[model samples]
Target: MEALKDYLPHSVEGKNILITGGTTGIGRATALLLARLGANVMITGLDEQHLKDALKDLYKEAKGEVYDVIADLSTEEGVNATFRTADSHFDKLDILINNAALPAGKVENGSYSEWQRVINTNLLAYTACTAQALERMKGDGHIVNIGSMSADVREETGSIYVATKSGIQGFSEALRKEVNKSGIKVTLIEPGAVDTDMQDQPTQEKKEKVENLEMLTADDIAISVLYCLSQPKRCDVVELKVRPHLQII
Candidate 1:
């Protein structure tokens, strides 16, 4: 057992981690797992009730400290407030997970305000959060951006979403090169057909899809995140593309 432990040298225990859009879906799942592993976690969400609820659940399973803040990442002020909460709670940040996002919609059908909200939440917030995280990190940190496979698929339905995700794909690649010299690792996880609130399907239908392997559960993506964090510092899992076995998209 001792020798087998050498396979993964890094550990999340005692590390300080901040996750954006963490009240529901993948972000919540990731926070729960990290908290269980003894990492101090700070989660940001837009809803006050949702934040309270998520914090209650997180505290139940967490070994290290758990905190939550109300944040609307679509605006600049919200992003600043979120990190200020992080600064007050944690002494330093070891990991940053950019997971907050809005649902997809066609660019042509939506109002300008709608498109702006989506862009700011999905793409711009990730970049802004990275900048804030970088300031707090003292070398040897990790940043995980939760992107989507829609970037590559480029389907007809959600052109705006595809744009932001595609931007993330390029942004992650470039950011990795920029941050690597500073000993900070950047990873992009692009998931396909995840059964989360983002999907408008009925609850039962989504459950059936997951059962049939047509869709992935939020927990599945959380496990992938844990895998990336547990690797040795010398190894950087740059990009991870995860899809369900039967998911065509």
Candidate 2:
């Protein structure tokens, strides 16, 4: 007569969590939900105004502490600054959600600087953040990486983006194995066609697509992230691929 709840061993309450690109989209939704669940949430963003705006909303429902840092994750100095700020506020780390990213064009369409920006922001930042988090996470922390379906689909005219996503997919797999023995769990949550700022569509158009089940909301992916985090230590929800029911690709 063992209930399903008996197997759910993890609880986010009081855990210190760090989320990047949390000013909007999936990262914002995840931060808000976790804050309401009584977790100490720290969010980062590139824009100071955006960081302030997100913190304003997070504190509205937050039961535990909530903090924000404004940093450009594409650079090494920025990554170091993010962790330094986190250390000042939180004594230790419990969860790291690598959700920061950007949209990109084809390799030939953009300049070398643009390509570097995309790669640094979308791919290298995840690895850099994980390294910093691993130092703070003694043995039993969770690292949730927000990859994309682009890794699998590899759509045309999106070679630059595909490259970064593909890198993340491989990075997450290797990271999981490397951290497995340390009791650290790594979960890769890949979402498809989410109606976020990254989407090149009007808000109403995006809503219509969502209503038609052709696209998903940020909250949809947030719930998936929460599910992966709430699993028992013995049960790792390794890779979760979330797509809208009617999304063609």
The residue-level lDDT of candidate 2 at 209 comes to: 95
**Tens-place lDDT digits, model 1, residues 1-249:** 346464432378889999999999999999999999889999999988888889989989999999888889989899999999999998889999999999868877889988999999999999999999999999889999999999899988999999999999999999999999999999999999999999998999999999999999999999999999988778899999999999775
| lDDT scores of the candidates, listed in order | 0.92, 0.93
In model 2, which regions exceed 4 Å deviation? 1-10
Measured against the true structure, the TM-scores of the candidates, in listed sequence, are: 0.97, 0.97
Q: In candidate 2, what residue range of length 10 has the lowest lDDT sum?
A: 1-10
lDDT of residue 11 for candidate 2? 74
TM-score of 1: 0.97
RMSD of candidates 1 onward, in order: 1.6, 1.5
| Cα deviation of 214, candidate 2, in Å | 0.4
Kindly give the number of clashing pairs for every candidate: 0, 0
